[model samples]
Target: MSKQSEDLLPLWTLSTTETELPLSLTEPMTPSRLTELRAVLAALAESPIATLEAHPLSAPADTSKGISLGRMSPLAQELATLAAQSTRSVPKAAGNSGEVLYRMVVPAKVAAEVSGGVLEPMISKAVPGGVRSALVGTNGISAHASFVPATAGAAGGSAATVGVAAAGAGALTVAAPLVLLAVAAGASAHADHKRQLEIEKITALLEKLHEDRLDDERNRLDGCRSAIDKATAILLDKGKIGLSLGLDTAVHTIDTALASAQRRITDWRAALEKLPPDKVELRQLNDAIAGIESPGSEFYVHLELAELAIALKRRVIVLQAVEHAQQDDGNPFESFTNSINLDAQNLEKIVTGLRDVLLRLSTLQLDRSHGMRDFTFSSGAVDKLLNTSHRLRALGDRVEAGRSQSDVAIEMVQKVDGSIVVLPAMAAE
Candidate 1:
């Protein structure tokens, strides 16, 4: 690629995007809220289409929605034009389009994380095939947008009241590996506690068998009674006594093994019952396994003994069913064989529903707040979300701004009216 081509590759601005989720329909959005929303959208839009080009399936519906850009709202058009006119004329970035533009917009980071890059290609595919992006010279343009919260942070360094709220809209992070290690270690320790139980069961069964073996007093008395009855009945009944004695000996052998097994089970149960509540999940599992008689259940018992570590290990399994699906790689188009699919994904579906509900409640709150012309949030959640945006905006501005590929942001300034995020640009075909 030529130097010009490289420059054009980065998103160029035709106009800055301004989200128009009507004040009447939304909680009056603050500058910081708008900033945060825009930053998130930008983060979403930053991902390159080439990164997603290999996927055979289409992007999800919401992802497409996030990248959407069309005829601007009239007020938006006016504001964009005014913003362009106000910024003092300067050198056009690299090549010469000479056309001053609005702040191009894109989805914020939250939207990107929530939807992935599904929307990027969807919008591109929708664009007319013949309409190639032909900017004058090599300067290609990126037109993008975002949403915002209605609250601003305070100045007295009271981050809680005026700045970023703790809930909802902070940076995305995960627990440390050490924490996971601890969880696994704890699980393993618990599993060890279970092994001791199985041993105790075996020990008890052996004792029960031995104790039942030598019951001489009762057996002798019964035998004497049998002899008396035989004498009264005559010679034919004496043969029956001998048969009964033999039968009793054989029955006791079988009875001893059964009693021993039962005792072993009782000991095992008692040992496991001593475990803490956290280990309860495992204890119940063992009990369930013991109750079953199938070979599968038997296998479960032995394997669990060896793999007590499995219970301790926790992992995020993505595309888990893909392994089985790969068995028929001889046919790619088969629905059952596609392991990495975009469909009725359970996790994504849940998040989508959650975002929708939040949006709906936000809309209702906006209607009630009368464009934030009043302090009337029905719930603390709305207020908290709004506050979080402001803090993110202030912090994000410090970290972003004037720090594009070329510009080095030294001691960042909070110049923009709202929140911000510095990340890659989204590709709209």
Candidate 2:
């Protein structure tokens, strides 16, 4: 290959043992891992001999041309921007003829422990000469280049020196052994760099996916809270008249149910706050997301139950009004009948709505692993409402029967003739 092509290849690639970081690059970075990576990058920014730059490669092996930042993943793009901002000025070596670049590829785990404190130690130990410049990417790939000054007739120097000499002589000359070593080293490093970059891209994708899942959870929580608040307001309004109409039992039951719902909402909010900020271990990530998505506390079911309770309370109040009207001398029979019929229709609707809410509560699949308990408070409230429904139905039946008897008496009086009609006992006397 031409000299231009050769310059694009990394001089040497060093990596952590494969067994140490067996995770696929496409896998998510655990919260700890993300933290470690940030520390390592920060240290790289402060290193004296190393200056990190972002190489936006189109493909892992296509290092010749860099793609735009828009084409990269969010994490990758973010790191690239950071790398730009944190880049230190590269100190130029006086009278340096050229530079030999060295590249290292290590797992994020190793970089955090070793390079986070200082990069010079690791650089001096890994590369043959003093590194002049370096570039690091989110993929755990760091490329370093050392400056070498060209002098006339320099013999038995490093491979870079020999190459410079060969080029100046305008002849195809090779220091056979040094050239072989350089070729082998560059080839190995290039291979490792390519593999590491591939893995980093995968990690970026996983991070994005995890973030999307979290967004969905937040939105769901917001909707649940809004619904609960609306239901609470309605229940509170209904409870205001409880004392006036001797509905203390109904009011207390509903208030307790509302308190239970509010408590669950608080628990869910706290759980959400405790979720990992960035990413989590693959083994635990699925469980964590599931917990948020389908928590056992049942906020929605509680809201429905509360609304049902409110409907039942309203019906009871209407029933009381109808009873009071019956005793009023000005109340017409037709008006009393109309009010009773309306109450009956409303009662039927409440019963139907309650049944639907109960069915939903039964079929709901909650995440029981998240310490979910039984709905004792809500269940008790439902039972109370049901008993009230039955009693009201019975009372309406009795009222209708009494009304029928009164109608019969009135008809008999209207049918009586002007002359007195006496029973058989009275005529005999």
The Cα local distance difference test for each model comes to 0.25, 0.27
- Backbone clashes in candidate 2 total 2
lDDT of 1 at 56: 8
* TM-scores for all predictions: 0.19, 0.16
Best by TM-score: 1
Screening candidate 2 with a backbone cut-off below 3 angstroms (N, C-alpha, C), the clashing residue pairs are 101-145, 102-144
lDDT of 2 by residue, 116-141 (tens): 11111112232222121232233433
Q: Score candidate 2 by TM-score against the native.
A: 0.16
User: Clashes per prediction?
Assistant: 40, 2
Off by over 4 Å in 1: 1-117, 120-127, 130-138, 141-322, 333-344, 365-429
lDDT of 1 by residue, 238-266 (tens): 11234543434433432343343334444
Residue 73 of model 1 has an lDDT of: 23
In model 1, the worst 10-residue window by lDDT is 49-58
